[model samples]
Target: MLKTESLPVLMLMGPTASGKTQLAMDLYDSFPIEIISVDSALIYQGMDIGTAKPTSAEQAAYPHHLIDILSPSETYSAAEFVTDARKLIKDTHHKGKIPLLVGGTMLYFKALLEGLSPLPKADEHLRAQILEKALEQGWPALHGFLKQVDPKTAQRLHENDGQRISRALEVYYLTDKPLSLLQEEKGPCWDYPTLQFALLPEDRGWLHERIARRFELMLEQGFIAEVESLMRRGDLSIDMPSMRSVGYRQAWEYLEGKCDKETFIFKGIAATRQLAKRQITWLRSWQGARLIDCQRSQSLSQRVILDLRSQIEKYPIFM
Candidate 1:
């Protein structure tokens, strides 16, 4: 049996359609590892087809934690993810298994690794007021206001990204402190030994092709019907976080007559590629993460397992 203290938390990160799920399953078959999903979309129930969530049979064979635990209407933040992941990591360790956190959500990984700033909680009144001002002056105007107060963060975010822009302004409104300064003050909370791996395709063109193909396959697999089912419920809207997921957003817009069929497919594929691009950018910024070329000829699972064994051998607790 492997010693509990010798096992490290394994983080498997990659862009969408980079074969992260397949590699994670291979690792699960080869080792005593429990999976904790790190994806934002997978947490919501009934968001299966669009999110490309694990099938019922796959989930049955290899149970994953923190997936399908929330309704689409409910909100989940990076802070909540940190709390849930930390608890799951401890639990998995106690059960003599290494926690294998797998997904493409870089924000969650960052929050779990580096602790969040002690910013004040979301204020509904303030949020509403901001939204009202945004409706009148537009998000770009609000972004300009943010640039005056927190230029560092404003430079990092896009003018169209209302969610983050509002949050940064909210922090300034509540605490009179820049969001960047608060984030810098906080230290990493997770001190345990961790082995981080990122799956990156050497050829960017090849990865883009893969993303387009995968999205087409999703549409063939009743993706539009899935979105229609959610829409018929009347409780969900395109503005909601769940519906705002890349492919889902395009599909929702198409169904609402905002776009034509051809445009919908093109937009969906383009959005997925953009999401992958953003994920790759985040992975590049991460320090000390081992990069796995997804295009390699050798079996990725075997290579990863061998690396894990080597790491275990060097661990002091194993000696």
Candidate 2:
């Protein structure tokens, strides 16, 4: 009843605790689409509770890809995700199914959508030297260094965004090239005709309240204990990407005795709120994304399904 030419790949994106998983499952029930996770943390093994990974039953019913595909000890990069995701998309299409990319990591979405810029791989020696300098000279000096070299990028990043600022400075210091230049040089390629959706609440306070409640739930769900297991592994350092996760970082502090249990939960909630704020800021910049308002809806899940149904009807994936 419909043409295959108009069946665009769908990307369902949202912040953590914004019901992306629920919405994706609802869509899965009605459509022949495989859920491909876009979250960075969900890729790791033994990180189920904190990451809010799908249960065995849910995954079995839905057939999600890119979850529990690796261990926390193994580092998975955005480059690898893009490569694997592209392969999955092609393979799924070949099998007469659509690919539905879903999750919270905006960078992963950017990697798949715009294509990765050809920046040199991180130089460990240079990164270490930069880290040492920052540790000795403080984060402000790193920010000043970045300002001197790549002022445009510096202006966009805040002084307190020490991680990104330090990384940007290190890249320039190592390669004598601005990271922005790499992005600009590699023009964006639309890899797929994509339909994007974001689940959001019209009221900010409602979403914030949801975030607070969810953080409480994570604590009850033994989030700290999960992080304890990872710390005991003795493989992760502060420099590792895994250390930068929301609840994981707080739990690390608790393990170090830098913060108590209360502080851990408090800081985790605060950090999650900050993360949601950043996600909202990024989502606003997305082009042509259909935003479903979750506020004032008695059944948020049903609303999402109806929206997806409308989109699928307009651009049917199966001919």
Candidate 3:
């Protein structure tokens, strides 16, 4: 367990393709910091090109925790992320290294910082029943039902967000209460000092262009082949959480003859931009976090290090 005197944990968060990985590596080179990934997509093994996972050389030089730890068929929940992150943070602190968490998974970050409600474990039978209903009536129909019961959560979630939608409905069915309300009742689980930083692009158009270029690079690196390899496993499908990721989903559909190459490229780029938009929304609403505009400045890693050093000087706990 992390004691009150442990050094503060540092979190570096940004949208997809925002150069967070490079910044984290620079920080590790300069400071005694160990990184723990907060990304949900990077957890699955064999998901590299689309996820833009760190290269094998990069991982060897600057190791990261919680990456490539699960099979594509396995499911990872925010609650489980909280448990795993806490343990990693504790272990890193014990080794006298600052815990630096980096990634784009906003929900995992929220669950880690704010804690989770005391909800019951997922009942697979109930979940299967809900999925069956979704298959019959469609997920949009289920979203409509969720709106009637938990309008707030429904409004927060996208109509096509099958995993979250099913979880919300399952909570309502089991407890007759709202998941949001239960979440509000919970307090932060780990209260040791912490610092959070968000990287935002001042020019939205520039970020969009970057997203497009990166997707093209992924394609050049055989992203389609990566998806095809996963599909050849005979155990994965588009419905699984891993396949539902931004670029992978579009690739899977295109491979299945659902769309042409032009449509696939367009959808993949659009999906990545949509994800960045949502991440920006979350960053805007986050309190007590410093926002760094990536477009306005160069050498973000040095800037972050200076800021962190300032904090460490003021609060020895950060040291």
TM-score (all chains, Cα) for each model: 0.83, 0.79, 0.83
lDDT of 1 at 49: 85
User: Candidate 2 regions off by >4 Å?
Assistant: 1-7, 126-181, 314-319
lDDT of 3 at 298: 74
lDDT of 1 at 99: 91
Task: State the lDDT at 77 in candidate 2.
Answer: 81
TM-score of 1: 0.83
- What does candidate 2's lDDT look like per residue over 187-272, in tens digits? 44655678888877788888889888987887788887888888888887655676777778888888899988888788988888
- lDDT of prediction 1: 0.89
lDDT (CA) per prediction: 0.89, 0.80, 0.90
Candidate 1 lDDT tens digits, 1-319: 6445445899999999899888888888877789999999999998998888999999999899999999888888898898899889888988777799999999999988888877778998999999999999999999998989999999999997989998999999999999988878764567778999999999989898988888888888899999999999888988998989999999999999999999999999999999999999999888979999987726787888899878766655423
Q: List model 3 lDDT by residue over 84-147, tens digit each.
A: 9988998888887889999999999999888888676789999999999999999999999999
Off by over 4 Å in 3: 1-5, 127-188, 314-319
RMSD of each: 4.6, 5.0, 5.1
Ranking by lDDT: 3, 1, 2
Q: Hey, what RMSD does candidate 1 come out at?
A: 4.6
